[model samples]
Target chain A: MPLSSSHRVSRRNLLKGAVALSALFAAPLIVSAPAAASAAAEQYVASIGKSILVVAGGSQGQMSGKFRNLMARHAAISAIGVFSLGKYRSKLPGSQKSEYYSLIEKFVAGLFVKYAPQFAGNRIEITGSKARSARDVIVSSKVHFASGKAPLEVQWRLLKAGSGFKIFDVRVLGVWLAIQQRTEFTSVIKRNKGDFGALLKFLRSK
Target chain B: MGVLFIDMVGMRDKGVTGLSRLLAAFCIVAATAIFIAPPSTLADGNRIVIQPVSDDGLDEIEEPGLDDPFEGVNRVIFALNDTVDQIVLRPVALVYRTVLPRPLRKGVANFLNHARTPVTLANDILQGDMKRAETTMVRFFLNTVAGFGGLRDIAGEAGWEYHSEDFGQTLATYGVPSGPYIVAPILGPSTPRHLVGRAVDILANPWTWILWDATTLESISPTLGETISARDDALETLDATREGSPDYYVTIKSLYRQNRESEVNNGAVLEEELPDIPDVR
Candidate 1:
């Protein structure tokens, strides 16, 4: 009745394969269908918009923690940090990787705190939503200002994170934040003769 | 009046006719191409379907890169254009933004948008986007009748947003290659295909015929107003972008590539390389 060593190894491999296949089949449950994702993305957008307005009005240092937590929970900062390097992704010096990530974290958090009031105070309206992929949803919204200035159009690109989703990138005023920075950082690196530290230096300057 | 008429007559000499008209049209477009440029995204937003163009899958669609083959000449023109923008356009736009009441500025933008509804409708029909064409017609009716000559965008308020459409995009839909980028004099970014498309849209504009200023053999253009409105609207964001950029030229080039590609695809999600971008509940 006892199996040989080879038979046991093959059995383990087959079980592992079955488990992996089942997980693959279950992947759709995260986002499920396009319609479901759209509704969930809309709700997520609404909640975030509400909180940002409530918490964003305070001083920079006062709101930094709240924003940091919000950002950490909601944004794909690591992915964005890597993406921001553009063609210079591999050129990132290993020793400075942690420093780069920390600096980028602060930079993004700082930007979040600064631009929140600009985009939030007027009025937040969920205009539309689209499924970029099964798990990636782009929810479009408008921050309409009471001042009659043009509304800020934001397309929040989200991917399924944990049980829900996280903000991957944002397109505001016809520019993607990550993409815009990609060009900037790459240019800095190039201007410095492909020294990755130059990018770090540039971010530090900012 | 007499001189313009004489010029018009002189323009008719054999093969030179098309060239002169093209020159005149090009001059007009160098003004209005601001309206057609890829970044002319004044829409509330558009929901476009992801339809397959060729037999190949969506993955086969190559990424549209910044094909700036004319980088050398483009930089020269872009520099010259930047200078003009700084010394002239930016200041004018700033003043326009500052002096004009918000309501009046809104009306100006709405009016300009309203004026182009017919042209958009025409392009929608040309591109065989019946669904979009239908929405265009509805928005036009609502904006013209209810919004009062399209000065309010009542249609947009009613959830029917007006998206920009043109022959350029139509040509793109049918798989035409838009040649190299050129920063047109005082007009910003363009390409050869776009130049041709602009000419067609210029002709498509009913005003090009309705309000023909025979003296100049050109359309009575609201393009100057359009340029100012666009500049005023984008003023703050552009200033920030310029200040932060190590190279504004490359920044703009990247933005243009993204903008044009997104517009051409009508904001459909065929998915990007990073398969699963996170989302929130």
Candidate 2:
């Protein structure tokens, strides 16, 4: 147990060497993590656009079941629904939470279905993306229609999930669809004395 | 200041004059706590990271959407406008685009922008946006001196991008309501607030003053050129929106309102606040 001075010096040196070696390997991984996240976010955003195009290609302005499912899978429907209710979130009929969520999903999908015919055969190009936080990335893109029209701008705000991302909000022409809905939904609720039924009817109209 | 930027934040750090400091303070106050544009729009040096996170974005959205109570009349006018566009405007713009090369057309856009600089500068100052005012001033100076009377955008090449500020956006900044959407025949989508703002802007413009008493066709030439340029640029985009929508009038009404909101939301820098951006660029 009583080591010589030379032996003690040799042990310390070996420990230091091991620490240095590990750092050399670990430093890059740590530094490049943000870059890796950015890349993933960019790819995810681009794929969403591509998948949309593929879904719309054969549908010809129709919302195929597949398109509805795709929207359901990516969108944070419950959160969006809850947020859109604003002050009336508590009044969203405890028995009808799922119904509210589904309606929100349908409302969103409806807009796409209505606009899909023009978008069919169109190309979606991912322009760039920047992180809002570790969990959020704003991915900017342009949709170029096959009819030789000028490109349409789209910005998607994605919230990072486990090994993937979920759609949070979208900005078109400087207005967020979710935010727009929130405005309308809250107003309708306010006008109807916080009637959840009225809100549902409004969504139905959309 | 309106619709996408936060600039001149570092001037104070660089020891600007006392008058500039006073003006900057006033501008910051006038901007009314607007968020800065996203950094991705420009080069690294031009990017300003605003770090303020405002309270729930919902607070801003609760305001009612623009009223379109005149649906019947607006639709009729919109139909007429569409007919006019298809018969004349589109053909004219197409011919104009064909007659002028890309460079020439761009030159026209640049010249128009430069010609409109006086009104833009005035709006920027009126909105108390010193940063935007400076940007307008520098851009006007550069283009006039080296851009051959703004037939070329030398300033744009120098990284001084062009952003137009108008009286409509200025009016919005001080909490003016956007009354109702209107289809003003040749002018297309507009609101009462915008109509008033346009009248003021025309009067505020130096060209209007110069051409007011003149007995020449020069006064309408810029208007014609602008119409053609805008139509040509938006030809395909408008067509797509039109074809896709069940109601082009309703779609345009929404787009116009949102675009106006976007314009008013761009302004003085706030650390950590997000700004609304226009789709134009």
Candidate 3:
């Protein structure tokens, strides 16, 4: 009976997971509908290069949560371009859990707070657009950080989800946050607790 | 490290297929040869010459053997491992991490942790070198039973005060030369020596009997649970942080090969500095 809550949630979660997976399987087709819509939006944003537009419905938490979940599973994180251990276990006798968590913690804590000036409330111009697929669009923009580091180039890859487009991935000047997660996390985790969980707790606490 | 490894053994794929097939044949031949290769053959260590297997340079693969059927098998094993963790083990780990009492968790950690060795803590104990024998016995016992428990903290601490036993380290101690790098199906990258060592380690596993003889469902219950819980705790950033190229598999294989080479060549030394361990009664 004590296991009931976890069991029940797990069952529901499994079903939800199934739905999510099916969505991924059917994604290319389901997303095509919004490709044209997103393309139109991209075209509109393209002309206004250097100008920022507030597009409603995209949640940073959703993306962050998904990204973190992937890391927790120790799955690969591909940001701009680097691969590091996203999990606690590695090829040696070290605290993989602590290492994984520490890096994730810093990135998670810095997520919106650090990135806010770039895109949160401000408007940046969409200088260029390259559509990789009906579902995959790479839109480039330049954002002046609060600390003002000369408007860095931000590449946004939006994926079609149902009737709307969701932010599938984000790369800052070819530097993807996802890929950087492993390298940064691995270094910090190895330093702090010899593992990955330390980073996770650090982030969650933030 | 990259240049050194390439110059020595060349890339892993240079002639791996041919080499593996040769090694596979060699295993059978060597086993047969053991009976016929003469008594002097077994006695002469000097007679064994380390011949370079192959040294072809890297090939720019047109399609690359990414879709090898063997690779698919390895992927399936990995996926199954993931599925077991996701479906059965993760929730349990979450509960364990969340609901477990601090003291009890600490007790578990102390009992399970073996990230370091007692010799490393020699000077801390007033008993000094006198406890070395006892320490060695205790260390061996703890590492063997609780190695897979994920609880290796001494005195409820989060990490182990010392290091734990692994196949790679064990092989190095035996003075077995690390043959060329290899990427095993499902197991990922290792060397010929370490690969053989891993298989031997698995065979020697004390829990193997419990796992194989026990009811399949019951046996997998704990492993799957632990794996999934570990996975969930890490699910958040698994993808976005990957720093590999488009050919992620090649990158992983190469990285594993390179890291193993470095670890072995550099010798298996603990990279972290741990404080002296207090005497354990």
Task: Identify the leading candidate in terms of TM-score.
Answer: 1
CA shift at A201, candidate 1, in angstroms? 1.9
What are the per-residue Cα lDDT tens digits for candidate 2 across B25-110? 34433432232222322221122232222234232322235555566887888788778888888888889888989778878877
- How does chain B score by TM in each prediction? 0.74, 0.72, 0.42
Rank order (by TM-score, best first): 1, 2, 3
The all-Cα superposition gives candidate 1 an RMSD in Å to the true structure of 11.8
Query: On residues A13-112, what C-alpha lDDT tens digit does candidate 1 reach at each position?
Result: 9999999999998888755688788899999988887676667766667786787777777777767776676545666666887788778877766666
State the lDDT of candidate 2 residue by residue for A142-164, as single tens digits: 78776543356678877777899
lDDT of 3 by residue, A1-206 (tens): 47776566677799999999999999988766555666664764453322222221135555455445433332222221112433322322334444443554446534533343334434465666665555455566655444322344566555444444444445542334443344454444655656445545544555
TM-score of 3: 0.31
Candidate 1 Cα misplacement greater than 4 A, ranges? A1-43, A53-69, A109-118, A121-153, A159-165, B1-64, B214-221, B272-281
Give the interface RMSD of each candidate: 9.9, 10.5, 21.1
Candidate that would win on DockQ? 1
lDDT of each: 0.65, 0.63, 0.39
DockQ order, best first, reads 1, 2, 3
Docking class of 1: incorrect
Q: State the DockQ, from 0 to 1, for candidate 2.
A: 0.10
DockQ values, each candidate: 0.18, 0.10, 0.01
Q: What share of the true interface contacts does candidate 3 keep?
A: 0.00
lDDT of 1 by residue, B240-273 (tens): 5566566888877666655665566665433453
